[model samples]
Target: MIRKIKLLLLLSVFAIGTAVADEGMWLPSLIHKLNINTMQQMGCELSADDIYSINHSSLKDAIVALDHGSCTAEVVSKDGLLLTNHHCGFGEIQQHSSVEHDYLEDGFWAMSREEELPNPGKTVTFLISVEDVTAKVLENVNDDMTEEERNKAVRKTLDQLTKEAKGDSHYEVYARDFFNSNQYFVFVTETFRDVRLVGAPPQALGKFGGDTDNWMWPRHTNDFSMFRIYCGPDGLPADYSKDNVPYQPKHSLPISLKGVKEGDFAMVFGYPGSTSRYKTSYGIDYTMKVTNTARVEVREKKLDIISEYMASSQKAKIQYASKHARSANYYKNAIGMNEALTKLKVIDQKKALEDEFTAWVNADQARKAKYGEALGLIENYYSDVENDKAREFMTEALLRGPEIFTFAYRVKPMVEMLKDPESNKDRIERYAEFLKIMADDFFKDYDASTDEKVSAALMKIYAQETKPALQPTCYQEIQKKYKGDYEKFAAQMFNKTVFDNKEEYLAFLDNPSPKVLEKDLAFQTAVQIYEKYNEIRNLVDARSDILEKGERLFVAGLMEMQPNKKFYPDANSTMRLTYGKVLDYDPRDGVTYKYYTTTDGYLEKEIPGDYEFNVPARMKELLLAKDFGQYADADGKLHACFITNNDITGGNSGSPVINGKGELIGVAFDGNWEAMSGDLAFEENLQRCINVDIRFVLWVIDVYAGADHLIDEMQIIR
Candidate 1:
């Protein structure tokens, strides 16, 4: 009954007309009631209904969650042409590239519809609608119930709600908990599977600045990619086929030729990934010391090893391009997050908030009864994170550090089934076939020698950095048999393991024997590592309930304590809208940064023959000739990128930066370096969303790349 009442109070709070300017990831469904007025006041010309409406198509229909929120993309043409960041499509591009035809170097442009390449596993999901389901999810859930019982009840209710929401439709339905599980919402979606690669600029432009300029400002990276969605004859989601036609979207964004300017109204709409704005001080400390530390330590070694192999040959570089970039991106992010958190004194801020929360709770007996234990519960659970730290280390340095163990772990089930003589032959055969297919894909990108070095180096780091007691069982053998020399062990393991060789692995799969598998050192090590991994996981999970409950109660108490203040939920890969403006900033006392960058700045950053800053000859020629075509701004300078104060994060990489008039101005790709801690705390004075100017994107397509056919499809508003 208490839980139900609390939820009802939360619903009322949700409708209150309090707005936190430039600091929220507002839900599209609730904007009509919660944020429409403020958004309009800030320069949004569209009504709330025009942004999201189930009765008719709105802007929501034009947006897509790329690969279920790994990134975001927007429909730019009536014929299903989609625009996203180049790095978002890096994997597919890398998959289709080879040494002989280096697409990453020369770039890819589909001159005609028939020339576009299909990506089998890629998908684009359009939201059908979102509805609040908090009351339904909390049904039969009460404060009297134990945490486990409450969870079970909520899960049961969510399952039922999802079923009813998807009744008799092809749409996908799922529910997400917001505000620390105090509120619930159900989303209905249509996922189209036949997404195709349409075009991308070469690395020279798309990823021009590379790691050196990744999270920094004044960025000139093009950072954009193009893909097309294909649908079945009836305009429903379908698998990739030659017969599929371009999807006719309900709405598409009109590209604006009127360029960005300082303080102009801007809005970013997409899925921003996970953020912990309400994380306690203890959680922040653990993230800096354990999570980020482990990632930086392990990935540094792994990246160095991969870089060496990549330098060995072009084939090796192509094979590891996407893998290296993916690992390095977050690896650097973790490092920067820690630096920014410490420099900004985020932990101190959280501690002060907790102190105030405690005072508020103590001042009133009623508040005390509801929230007195929240901080205690949170602090107590986080005080002992030894097992959690070890688990993080194990994940980065062993399980995910080396590719071999994870790939080998896949066959564990099949091996177990093979051990049972009474196991069904058909089931075993089907599993074997699946393993064969897996092996084919794995070996295509696998280089045993490179993996061996990475495995050895990362294992050494794990042994040196982590406590000995938490080491996996295989480490015991390494100490006893190999004298703790990880390199020797890795060498012997790689030489003997059939998992390292595709043909050998295929042969072994053809003839299954448990006895033979038991003798395999890599398989034995993988099983032991996974067992220890599970043990640590269980230990950490055992203590997680207290933290979960504490956070929920704390968030609830905060709402009650401050009834008039507006609050926004943290990012959780759900569609959100954030309104701000195109504005410059002062990074330091002496630095006044500009809001935009031009092609001249792009040229100024060039280092001739350098890997990261080398300009392509054709691009250099175009820039030297000042041939920017219709895409150049009024100043007659070709703008490369710009900055806006719009709030964004990881999954928002390719989100469209829309102007007040509901037109695409740029494609948001990164956030400024000064506010790397923006995810945890909105740095109102410093945080900026970096974007590739739309005019620059068009210039590349119309003049440099000569892909004018692609531009003909867009509805350009000059």
Candidate 2:
């Protein structure tokens, strides 16, 4: 029976083989086959025949959009309509909403082009291409060098490369890696720093069901957003400009009314952030068994505290969003990691692979002697940092939140004092700068009571966790300055009395007030104590360098061990191509996930009382009428969703789901439940990428929202 179950599982996975793992990172020779120079000349697009000849020069125009929160977006519509995941744009949508006009509750419609709200300070960048500058980058560092020296060498090389290659152009250069340690790619990116928000669906529609429904299948979330990149008078990227024109992209995915069917070949194009599946079996096992569990525990605990406070006050909600977002991310990761590890039997497979490698190494005397102690060193280092990691997260959260808030309000006047004299400028500039930032935060319609509660809770945590020697100096100073009354101190510090009267807030800046500077000194002292904690972390990281090196060696050894089985190192926030076909999934326990869902699914998931899943009346009306029109699939089902075998994570959210024709079919969003572990391990066994079918996006614009004008601007292919 057990064997039968395993066989069934394997068969099910094979049915979705495109979504499953292969030996190494799957780079279709089709994309990389062409030479870099030809690709650049062709503007990053190629014919099937041309794809066969791709080379290093071909990659020059393929840009890497890095450090995006969830996923990067590409411009798809000529009229400045941007495509990105619904979740990535959720925050911006919610930010633009209010109680009176509950965009989150009912969704949004632009009505006309002018009605589109402008997003300030949002930017999208494109890498024009990359060049090999390894010799330029590594000129200062030898193979055998200290970490500090290596870091310095890398910095100098990057600085020189940027200085030389930039040549007065508005481009940023970055050094990247390929094929693990064997190759390097230097990307020169044309950064469109002036990106603006276009439109986004409300949170209820975009992030429907929240964490509970996250990573699950048969999902009904309409996770999509729109943004526009802007350029200056010269048609080049410039700083914020009200008169800036919309950027003209070299390529844009045309909206496809012809929807996908099961088994149809599809691909996702974008920058996928990071993954760790290529680590040693020992590392993977340790992460799954120990690191993931501890991480989950810490996040759950932190979430509990955040939820409690957020539920009580709106101020707490705003203050804790940054904290909550981080906690939720880790919590989600832990859950996904646990599921992936268990489903893949990652530990067992890792053990088997490790055993085979050990046998091979032991038979080779020289290699055996070199690598015998590597695993031990890794194990010892992981164990040492295990306890400290959790505390570090907790500590960082406390410092970032209420503690930072308290210090900011207390030291506002000292920031104003720094402008008094140049000599005092150097000493007080950093603190003054910090205080100004805090003032902006404190005065921003924050709930005083909730801030106080968070501050008090954090103080207690600090008291409990801080070393004895450090506590007295820090807390004593705070207590002495605030008269041993935290509540009173908070009340006086964050009071809007000074700021509510604009004249006073601005005037406070003019006066070189000694009384205000005293309070600032108190806060400065607290910041210093926080700095001490950071110093300790730096020390810990320094000591762990040896272990990190050993782990890297172990990883290298394992890769070498898998000689014939093409193995790729883990993703390091670079652009990658994942190819697969549209397909459905049968997760387990008789549950099956269809490859595509329709507009009707949104209504089906609607719960009248549940805010997250509750559908707006108009949305329900549109679905009930079956008004899909041109967007309807051939079978008459309104094409609302589809699936792909793309290996993606957070940063891949807003990626374009393209066909072989390079047309946009859907906007990439979440991955299936079985594939949540894709971040840790790309389980060829079950992971599948989920996307909002482009048909659904058009349907929402044309039929549901009645924004036919917006639809008309797009290059729609029926």
Candidate 3:
């Protein structure tokens, strides 16, 4: 019923000829009713059914959510040759890397099928179908119910709906809320677990310009990697086995050598992680002051410690490579987001919109009765953020900063079983064996000394940034016993804790004792920190509900007040289609940025002996020789990357940029720095999706690495 109203509202907007182009992450399943005309007007050659269909294979079949939506990947060959961003596959690459075979520095390529590296516990999920389940989920819910009761009712229905949707099938079924829980959808998905690494360029090329160039325009990073999917003999999802064969995909994208030019229609289809487009001014203030600030402060210190260890040896570098990149990516984003939010005057704009809503509601008694308390509820939620601020700092500094606490916390259940004298001997033995395996995985990349330093530094910051009452009890112990010397405390804990030494920890696990676990300082500290964190969470739970309810009411009221305006739901890690054109913009006064960058620009940015900007001798030779082969543009230059106005976010990192004819042109990777505030509120003119030209990706794969065998599998169109 709600879906019908939304579609009618959208149709009315088009009927009045007031519908705008672009700037939305629209659902692909509803495009036929809501956006097909607009997309056709924008020069898309394919019909709605060609892009997404349940009865027949379509473009949607080629795209899969990598690792269940951390990133996106597209099949480029019938044999399930998948392409995604290098960073999306960074963790897998780092895991396979070592001092003897540093895949991060030297890159990895499997010349033969037998050489491909299988990734256990990795998966790629394909959407089988999506159905609107809002009516069903909300049937038992009502405005009279408290938020807790409402949630219970909704969860009960969602569980039954998902079970029915997945009945007698191997598919995974889940429900996602949209438009602030005003609507819901159920998705049936197929997940293939046997994913393998095929090839990836070295960090020098894949991550060129590194932190200095990330999220900036004119990007020269190749930023692409290749993988393959394997299936069982019956052609279904299965575990890794030598007997498995390459998956035969229903559809695969055809590569287009006809590079993109400005004004060329383009589209991206992927699972966008999340966006709070309707966030109020108070919420925005909280995000900048508390959320972003805590992340930057905690990570600023964490990255320094990781980098110091990384520089100590190649082994350490490989161990911390993925961890550092993951931390730094968001640390920089938070800084950039704060800057963009302030400079763009987003809070002022939101306040103005709130004022307008207030005026509109006051003009009508009916609206006043429905939405009079919307803004008040939201404001009240943010009225006192002292506890909230402490919570965010605690989360960043203690919960996430040091790896040791969380790693040690994993054995809490095992300790409980040991404490119970009635626990079965076999059950205890099984858990001990499980802990041994976990210890091996944990200690593989962990350096206790590094963690020790991180814990001490972050603990000090947490003490200073948060109020004394919010500090964990462990800090109180430190203050009394260690004379407030966190360094001394950390040193003593590191020396005494069995967790710092894997062999000692495993030996202790062999003959585990409840008394020993109780006396362990690290375990005791972890328990204290987690218990306090939970206390903080409970303190804020009621206030968070206020914000959630206010936002939902505000959105629903706005839709009713403006019946002619078309509204799209915020992203929630579900498949969406956003379309636009290859275009450039002037980021600021008198500075018109170009739509594309070339190999020449890449060389110009090179710095000798610099890790971030150093030029590979082979890459330099090829660039200077102008040996781009067929990948060169009409101007006889090798284009590195291009920009488009298509709306995208984090999880869309490796989505394919398809032209009007549905041929792959580039791989969507980053968003320009000018629009770091885009996740909160999109700035259409400044928000550009940065993509690595498919030609550049191919050039590195075929020419630079001379791995032509991989190229032969793709269907290329000139």
Candidate 4:
């Protein structure tokens, strides 16, 4: 009788799979699963076979390389020309900017190949391949082990794998969970450490639209930057080398002059950062309603403060640029998410799915007994955290408040000690690293007034909410020590002359004196504050474990409830491929957008005398002269269009849009406003990415900038 019952239970699980088999949310088994028949029903089309043939040829040749700071770039030329988004290369570009050069304002051009600027310590990576290693990863974890134990064991196993596989190269290996931890895939990446800047457009061109048009559609932004990857004589990856040559790529997308039209098939291929469609209704609703709203409000308030301060001072404007950019991005995402949730009715769908899963779990006696208690635990914890969210934010603010001031104080003492002959080697070396970091910060366009305002506000927030025992008199201490002499302090700390050579600084960290240790209190304080937060965060995380486990079981039950069907798990920053074609839209309230815009639109959108929207005189002249030449599309309208149905997000900016023929068509920049909810739930009804046509890029190089030498290297096709 027991054996018969077990067989019946297994049969029931198989039965459920058949029910959900038809849902479009299932993970596709192959690339062809994204064809027109399947995707078109969701408003995407398959590219023609000829186009696919071409794109496959080109895409296979493009080498996927990771850039410095976890960003990605692609090598597009044999001479080591690299392409990435302006924002991705913003730091490097800013490093080269100065009062005389002002590269940020006027842009940079290599008058000749030899004149290209070189940046030290920047690197790029190439993704080799992926393999399934789930069995090896989870071999030590048994069903009897607690979730924490399982997690620790899995982490240790993956770390061992990475260490053993790393070899002598600077490669990185990631053990990624797939299908909600039911499976796993391991990725091995080869990284090159030598990368340098080649050229970049001025902020006016690269970030032309700025804050106003940032998240809005019908954009005319030209957000591109150039870099080069350097390698040793043996064609192996190397650190910064003056004698290095450009690393050759297995694939470089050819430039295409074919413009996209309405209903034309388009696809994008790149690493998308994340998505959260499989989340519980509780989580999804909270993000869409509570978190997003609060985030937008915070950013809006911050932006107002920044704008007010910047208007009165030039230094303030520069200092607040980074803050403004960060806030603007969040604000844009919040607004987009709100719009998408409403359009897709995501909350309702999530609730319905949850309800179905709940019914399934309750029907099974074993599942009911196991998850029944877990569900209550999850709910209780979520309620507690919801009440304490504001307190948590306040605590985080206090911990980060003294970051700048601490660096300023520590750098001076470290530099002085390093210059001494008796300085410890290890101590000096550590100080040198700190100095390098300080240099990066000092070079940044920082607005003193804005920083002061932010500091004041943060301190006030901390004072109001923090427990007295945990609070520090940071603001008072800062004022007392600096005594309105921040400029002198900054100069002493960052001036290269004071620090002398790197060797001297390395010695200071090794034989640190009492004074140096006392000065390092900021670092100590930071560590202590982080530890406190970590304790609280870990408690919350423990509670969240119950929620995750319950959700996973619910997902499994849902899967079992439907037979012969597949469902793709939520994205967790792993590599994924989404396919689609280019198409136009009629969003709402009589708003009609074409699949592609022309150079005329870019010029027409320019407001005369407006610093943000105004086009440079030279670019305007080129546009008026109709010097499109060979870059014009098939329609003779200057092929400034292409299409794709690739799934992407913020990290996907500057990703190449390749055709089936394996030719470059455009660069992915942003998603349409209607698809902002795509990060949470992909709605085939609205999600589409916007890209800058490669022809537009070519035209900018050939006509506007007269960079014919750069243009001659590309395999431009009609």
Best first by lDDT, ranked: 3, 1, 4, 2
Candidate 1 — which pairs collide? none
Error of 2 at 687 (Å): 0.8
The candidate 3 region of ten consecutive residues with least summed lDDT is: 8-17
What clash count goes with each model?
Answer: 0, 25, 0, 53
C-alpha TM-scores of all predictions: 0.97, 0.81, 0.97, 0.81
Candidate 3 TM-score, C-alpha based: 0.97
Give me candidate 1's TM-score against the actual structure.
0.97
Per-residue alpha-carbon lDDT of candidate 2 for residues 300-413, written as tens digits (9 for 90 to 100): 655676678767744445454444665686578678778767876766765665676678778888777656665666667766653354345445434554544344445444
The runs of at least 3 residues in candidate 1 whose Cα sits more than 4 Å from the true structure, single-residue gaps closed, are 1-20, 420-423
Q: For candidate 4, report its TM-score.
A: 0.81
For model 3, residues 1-718, the per-residue Cα lDDT tens digits are 1223233234222101123566888888988987888888888999999999999998999999999999999999988899999999999999999889999889999998999999998899999999987767777887788777888898899999999999999999999987777788899999999999999999999999998998999889999999999999999999999999999999999999989888999999998998887888999999999999999999999999999999998899889988999999999999999999999898998888788889998999987887888889999989989889989998999988999899888778877678674655677888889889888778889999999999999999999998888888989889999999999999987876788889889988898888877878888888888988999888998577888878877877766766766678788899988999999999999999999999999999999878799888988998999988889999999999999999899999999999989999999999989999988988867889999999999999999888899999999998
Looking at model 2, residue 256 earns an lDDT score of: 72
lDDT of predicted model 1: 0.87
Q: Give lDDT tens digits, candidate 1, residues 362-418.
A: 999988987889889998998898899889999999988899999888888877687
Please list the residue runs of candidate 2 whose C-alpha ends up more than 4 Å from where it truly belongs after superposition. 1-70, 100-102, 111-114, 133-155, 177-183, 281-329, 369-373, 400-445, 456-529
The C-alpha stretches of model 3 lying farther than 4 A from their native spots are 1-19
How does each model score on lDDT?
A: 0.87, 0.59, 0.88, 0.59
